[model samples]
Target: MNAKSLVVIGIFGIATPALAAAPTIDQLIANPPLLNAEMDRCKHLGMAANDDPRCQTAWKAENKRFFGNGVRYSPEPVNIFRNTPDKLVPAEKQQPIPPAPAGAPHG
Candidate 1:
């Protein structure tokens, strides 16, 4: 391959994996609120957000371990890696019920 092409490929190879890797909650938090992960292992394990690299690594590992390979993309991506399994609350946690007025059924 040509020298220029080799250099381009080298750069692309390094950058591609970085982008493809699962993102950390802190990474998502740094930007606007977006997708949520199902299991924030970092916080669950009592790690700091500053430990983002370690978090991402563990997140991917555990994700594949439990759900099998390639199941990393949950309905809520980053939230999974950033919240507890039982308390992985989503935005739609509460459903609105009609408020009962005075003397309403069981009010």
Candidate 2:
């Protein structure tokens, strides 16, 4: 083989091990912080990221982390607004708003 070909082979032989040493998606997802950072990176990639395997894996991992085994957890509904009276809390037990001081500059 020519010297040029030998040099090219030598360079690839030295580089292949380094490339193999790179972590896989499972390894990256094992660490929560790393997974979160990867998710952020995927988010910044925007719509184009949907076609990226790394981004897809990161999103799936995040979904599993949040939703738990693909089952979505739906919490019971809560009524926070005062406009509607809540049946849960009895009106008698509810605290009454104290009357504003007489003639206090109206808001």
Candidate 3:
């Protein structure tokens, strides 16, 4: 083989692995561009987007793929003293100490 043919063959040999490693269609579809385009198109539809079946389906699919069902937020604040038994009750609510019994030997 000529030197040029050998160089071409060597280049192909190196490039073949890279081409083979490229993502498949399903994998590419999961990436940002495809989903982002769908979302952008839906956004362009404005209020009617909610009524569009295609937009709804795409939104649901994207939500499920990226976030599962949905995220839940608690309305109540977290109690930092929840696990501390001693600190559960406020100091103000505790009973006051009684006076000493009949002035028994005033110290």
Candidate 2 achieves a global lDDT of 0.75
lDDT of 3 by residue, 33-105 (tens): 8667767888999999998776776776676676655546678766767666744556676687988778567
- In model 2, state the lDDT of residue 68: 62
Candidate 3 overall lDDT versus native: 0.70
lDDT of 1 by residue, 1-107 (tens): 89999999999998777545565544554433322342454566565644667566555545554565464467854654544685645686678898976675663
TM-score, one value per model: 0.22, 0.44, 0.38
The TM-score ranking, best first, is 2, 3, 1
What lDDT score is found at residue 25 in candidate 1?
45
- The best-first sequence of candidates by lDDT reads 2, 3, 1
Q: Can you list the residue pairs that collide in candidate 3?
A: none
Q: Whose lDDT is greatest here?
A: 2
* Clash count for each candidate, listed in order shown: 11, 0, 0
Those runs of model 2 whose alpha carbons end farther than 4 Å from true positions after fitting are 16-28, 70-107
The per-residue C-alpha lDDT of model 1 at residue 53 equals 75
User: Which residue pairs does candidate 2 place in steric collision?
Assistant: none
Q: For candidate 2, lDDT tens digit of each residue in 1-107?
A: 99999999999998777543433556666788888887888889999889988787787777766666643555866666868855656556668899986886768
Against the true structure, candidate 1 reaches a TM-score of 0.22
What is the overall TM-score of model 3 with all chains considered together?
0.38
